[model samples]
Target chain A: MRTIRVELGERSYPIHIGSGLLKNIGAYCQEAGFALRSPLLVVSDSTVAPLYLPQVEEALRSQGYQVVTHIFPAGEASKSLAVYEDVMTTAIQGGLDRHSAILALGGGVVGDLAGYVAATYMRGIGFMQIPTTILAHDSSVGGKVAVNHPLAKNMIGAFYQPAMVVYDLDTLLTLPPRQVSSGLAEAIKHGLITDEVFAYWCREHAEELLALDLEALGYALELGCSIKAKVVGNDERENGLRAVLNLGHTIGHAIEAVGGYGVFLHGEAIAIGMAGSALLAAKLGRDRAIYEETVSMLTALSLPIRLPEQYSEDDLMEAMKHDKKFKEGKMTFIIPEAIGSVSIVNDIDEQLVREVLAQLKKEDNPW
Target chain B: MRTIRVELGERSYPIHIGSGLLKNIGAYCQEAGFALRSPLLVVSDSTVAPLYLPQVEEALRSQGYQVVTHIFPAGEASKSLAVYEDVMTTAIQGGLDRHSAILALGGGVVGDLAGYVAATYMRGIGFMQIPTTILAHDSSVGGKVAVNHPLAKNMIGAFYQPAMVVYDLDTLLTLPPRQVSSGLAEAIKHGLITDEVFAYWCREHAEELLALDLEALGYALELGCSIKAKVVGNDERENGLRAVLNLGHTIGHAIEAVGGYGVFLHGEAIAIGMAGSALLAAKLGRDRAIYEETVSMLTALSLPIRLPEQYSEDDLMEAMKHDKKFKEGKMTFIIPEAIGSVSIVNDIDEQLVREVLAQLKKEDNPW
Candidate 1:
């Protein structure tokens, strides 16, 4: 078992990663200082619940902790206020107290939604992130829990940290190939943003990671979580330094929004955005090698580096304008200076972004 | 103007109280360091909007702030998730950026609804409290912002502090006599729990406060805000010391719920709960003068000290069971030790609370 602590002072908590940890969830809860007297609410999505909910409940109940379960349909659409309200209703009906904790038992969507439920329920309660998917390696580590609004993704949320994060790697054995690639995109992002060696390591071990090699996958997740935890700990509210973590997010969110959040997974969209950022860096007269290397890394993991031809540049630009990163009619892009390094550049030219989008949409590789 | 600062380390902010302060709101915004580049959203209810929103918008506009206004229907019913979502829609549609500020421009309902919006919008933006009612003196300063759920009041909310609180004494002139009494309930509560002298002063100057004498009201509000700010500063998340701020909230919230939150205003219900707390303290072997003095103070301000006969004791107890303060099937009551001191007592006998309720509902004065 490997444990990484997110150093947020009083709000600090640990992320425990290992095999078959779900069966010992009760012991984890006890070690994490969760009281048995208070009832616990386990929020899961339909896909993850059928597989793991019974084991989680049995473990908690065996430890004399009252357990209540709330399962919503599995998808990005479930990350809405209406679904958040449903989970809140279950929490209220379940008689969960202020001390009671809400455990997220699925992937990124479930983690985001349940973390948000904990953030606002009774003006913030105890929350534990139990990430089941590889993509959640990014979402669950940071305290940025939110439900998407009709107008935009993650428009409504809070920076409420969790009590702990229990990552049971055994759950990842069930993920399909597409989801696995999607999840690894963020793991690769961690390396692309700060760790040069890890970036090359991820690309080198792409097959092992994709083939569900436990040792390789475990090492990647731990490194990714550590990089994310360091960034989040320094700037919890994204005042300045934290913006670097959004290297691909500015353009990435736009891609996700333009694709209606369904056509592409969040990690897939971000992978393309990272590719776009590298291209944008080259357009701004940075080294062209940045673009080549980013695309190479993403492609090695079977992640797409091109936008679907159907999405128009104008629509993508419109979506970027609605993003939280867009300010005063100016786009803020986390432009890559080189591999494992980035700089936050404000007021990037719209025409340059459009040019990059056009190039990305080409049927052939621009490189 | 009188300023009392809530010392919350980096989150600390000032409460500005005086006559005609709204006319100079633009100056306050500038002094508090609100940026002119980002647009500002003002959230008001129909009633307060008609009275002050125009002047506020004009003031902000004069200071080069691009202002947008969102007004919902007036009253407690407006503080629901639906209205909260409506305000969020208006905020998004208004093109509010991360740096933009949200000004809560009404009483507690508007402040709570708007503050919750700010707390969650783009993972929180800048928020300022512009209070237009005497009741807001209590609500605005403490940063306890929330909207009610169908199942409960303040069930969904956050302890998000505002940039500053602007209390314009002129707005209090428009309040009706019943509102004057309702608002004073909290002011008297602040004094009762912390300062014996202030509590007696509130009783002594009841007529001046009700008559809208700006001098007396100003002094009273400053004192009340200071008391609250001190308590809130010491304990921001209600881990321990802050629970005393709920002097009458346990019983007060129960009464409000049983009455469907419409029959009595929040302060009025709390007034009766204060009376009930005094009775409970007496039953627990405290001085009988505590009950008499409390009833005398409430009556002096035209606040009710008795629950209406329509509410059954059983119904009130059931409501208490659902309160956030109720834990492990035990009631946590802020019991008065004397006229100006209180203590948080947990696991109080339910039957004893029932007796207090029965006594409070009687036609005759139990004291």
Candidate 2:
């Protein structure tokens, strides 16, 4: 098993990446100072619970853990306050204690919502992540768990770290093809911000990865998680260099909000967002080829490059104002200086944004 | 103004304590980089809204802030998830943004509930505290903001820090006698844990304080807030040393929980809780005299030493299980080692708690 430590001092935890990691989660909890006999709360969604919840529960129970599972419907809708209330009530009824760690066994939706529940439940309980989809490889390790508010996505959440995140590669075998491509958006972000070699690797292995090449996929997952762990350790609250991780997220979140949260997958929205940001970068005097290259790479992965129907430039601008990055009533965008470089720019001209949005709007094709 | 910094690195904020400080809040926000022209969302309760919200709004408006006020019914009952939802929706309608700072202008109930709203609104927005009651002297300083769940108090909340805390002593002049005494419980606790001089002062001015003696009360308020500031700075997440501040709160919370939250003022419940903890300490052979002294001092201040006749010891124990301090189903107690000394003791004997409860059962004539 390969391990990457997210160094957040007392809040720090490890992400174990490999096959068979799920079967040994109880031992990890034991080593993390949790009681082996303590009850484990397995939190998941309707989509993933049926496939992995039983195996995760069995894995813990085999090592003497008394497991109780709670499943919510999968989608952005499940990240509401009502759902948070229900999940918390269930946790209390199941007799979860500090020693009774929460095992989040699902994709990004379940990971974000359940991680938030664990963070606030009893002022936080121990939690371990058994990421089932490729999308979770980034989210599970970063500790940025949140539920979406009506006006915004991830508008209600905390920067809470998990005790351990077990990213079992074997679990990804069951992830849908579209989900894998969606996740590549984040992996692409890590490459664009810090690692050029990883960017080239992604460029080379796009097809192999889409074909479910296990070794290539495992390397990509570990690399993404390791980079995330380092960034989170250095800047957990995303104040400084950590904001670099939000390369495409600013415009991406606006897309998600404008389209309404559940209309597009998180990574799918980000794919188009990256395109918009890249276009903005080219307009701001960054290399034109880098923008074209980014679009081509995303398109080759079969990720959507078109903005959603019914979303206008004005709607995107309005949605961007709601972003946490907005300060002094002006939206900030993270634009690339080049393919392997980016910066958080707050002084971008609004007219420039309008021009880029106008270009994105005038595209002939929807996808 | 005397400033106390609750230093949690980047999340650190100033606690400005002095008389007439509310008038300068606009200046402080501007200097802190927040635009004073943005609409201010003032969240308070009905009891405090009529009393202080006008002055607060007047001060902000005079400085060109577009102030919008929201008032919920004043009481512990208002600290529900329903109330929080209402506040969030109102904030959305009022155009509150990441730039807009929420001024929580009331006692503990307002501070806890509003702070939780600020913590989750748009995934966290900047908020300030204009504590109008003595009980707020404690709630406003620590970043531990939360609302009570049906089965538990503070079960649903997060450790969200504020931009600044404005403790204007003039606001405390209109505070009721019961609120004054409630605030004193924490003042007494600070003395018990770290400041012996404050403890002695509590004993000396018990009568004056109960009568709202401004000089004595202000001194006590400053001392308590300063001590809490020091502890919170050192342990933002309550990992170790910060638990000292919760002296008597573990059992005090249980008592309040069993009594249905609003029946007993928080300070009244804590006063009795201190008596119970002192008795427990005496039984444990740490400092019997200190326990007796605390009980005597509480009696002198006219604080209740008995739990409400309705709640049985079993009900208190059941409520204690929901406390955040419960690790693996075992409730931990913050017991005194001696006067001016405290420690978290996990191995408290249940029979001893029953004995303490039995003492409350006795219908006594006079001390």
Candidate 3:
């Protein structure tokens, strides 16, 4: 078992990573200071709920903890205000008190939705992240819980830290190949942003991670969470330094919105956006090797490096304008300085971005 | 102008209380570091919009701050998630960025809804409170922003502070007599919980306050804000001491809920609850003078001391049970120790609460 603490002062909590942690969830709750007298709410999605809800409930109940479970449809569409309201209704009906805690027991979508419920329910309550998918390795740790707006993603949310995050690696054994690749995109992003050795390590061990090798996967998740925890701890509110974490998110969010949030997973969209950022970096006369290396890393993990040809550059640009990162008709991009470091470059030219989009659409891989 | 600072470390902000502060709002925004380049959002209600929105817009525009205004129908009914979503849409449509500021330009409902919008929009933005009602004197300061759920009031919300609170005494001149009494209910609540002298002064100058004497009103508001700021500063999240601020809110909220939130102004219901708290104190073997003094204080300001005959004790109890303050099938009451101090009493007998309700319904007030 490996534990990484997100040092957020009084709001700080730990991320526990290991095998069979699901069976020991009750003990973790006890260790985390959750009250047994208060009813605990377990929020999961349909896909993950059917497979693991019973075990989580049994574990919690065995410790004399009363449990209430709410399961929503499993998809990014579930990350909407409507689903949030439904979950909140279930919480109110379940008679959960301030002392009661909410445990999010699925992937990124479940984690984001449930964390948001905890953020606003009774003006914030105790929240624990139990990430089941590899994509959640990034989202569950940062305290950026939100439900997407109709016009944009994560438009309505809060920076609410969780009490703890319980990551049971055993759950990842069930993920399909596409999901595995999507999740690893974010893990690889962590390596690309701040850890040079780890970035190369990820590309080197791509097969092991995709094969659900618990030792390799666990190490990657821990490193990814640690990188995220450090960035979040230093700048919880994203005043300046925290914007570095949004390296690929500016264009990444635009891709998700243009694709209607269904065609591509969040990590997949971000993977392409990271590729775009590298391309943008080269366009701005940075090291050309940055673009080659980023694409190489993403491709090794079987992550998508190109925007689908069907997604027009104009639509993507329109979507970018609606993003939270777009300010005063100017785009903010987190461009890679090298493989392991990035810089937040604001006021990037629109034409340059369009040129990169055009380059990404070519039939043959072009450098 | 008298300014009282709510000392919340980095989130600390000033409460500016004086006559005609609205015209100087642009300057306050500048002082508070609001950016001219980022568009500002002024959220008002139908009632307050026509009265003051133009002036606020002109004031901001004159200072080179681009302004976007959103007005919802004025009432407690507007504090719903649906309205919150609408405001968020306007925020997104208006191109409100992270640097943009949301100025709440009405009473508690507007402050709460707008503050909640600012709290969650793009995962939180800058917020300012421009209070137009006396009741807002209490609501705007403590940063307890929320939108109500169908099941309960303020069930969904966050503890988000504003950059500054601008209280213009001039706006109160337009308030109807009933609204005046309603607003004073909260101002007087601030006095009742902490300051014996201020509580007595509220009764002594009830005529001037109701008549809208700027001098008396400013002094009263400054004192009330100071008392509230001191309490909220010590405990921001209501971990302990901040619960004292809910001295009259528990029963007050129940009364408001039972009355369907439309029947009684929040302050009026809270006035009765304050009287009830005093009566409960006497029933708990405290000083009988506490009950007499409470009734005298409320009556002096034309505030209701008794629950209407139309309301059933059973319905009120049911409403109380749904209150956020009610925990684990136990009623938590903030019982008055004297005229100016209170204690958080948990696990109070339900029967005693019923007895007080029954006594409150009597034609002749009984201690």
The digit string of per-residue lDDT tens for model 3 on A57-89 reads 999999899999999999999999999999988
lDDT of each residue in A112-191, candidate 2, tens digit only: 88888888886677777778888888888878898876887787788788888888788888878888899888887788
Q: Which stretches of candidate 1 lie over 4 Å from their true place?
A: none
Say which docking band candidate 1 falls in: medium
List model 3 lDDT by residue over B228-250, tens digit each. Answer: 99999999999888888887788
TM-score against truth, every candidate: 0.99, 0.92, 0.99
Give per-residue CA lDDT, model 1, range A1-367, as digits (tens).
9999999998899999999999999998998787788889999999999999999999999989999899999999999989988998888888888888999999999999999999999999889999999999999998999998888889999998989999999999999999999999999999988999999999999999999999999999999999999999999999988888887887788888887876798888999999899989998999999998999999999999988889899989888877899887688999989899989999899999999999888767764
What TM-score describes the B chain of model 1? 0.98
Worst ten-residue run, lDDT, model 1 chain A?
Answer: A358-367
RMSD of 2: 2.9
Task: Give the Cα error of residue A227 in candidate 2, in Å.
Answer: 3.4
The runs of at least 3 residues in candidate 3 whose Cα sits more than 4 Å from the true structure, single-residue gaps closed, are none
- The complex in candidate 2 yields a DockQ of 0.53
Under the 3 Å rule for N, CA and C atoms, how many clashes does model 2 have?
1
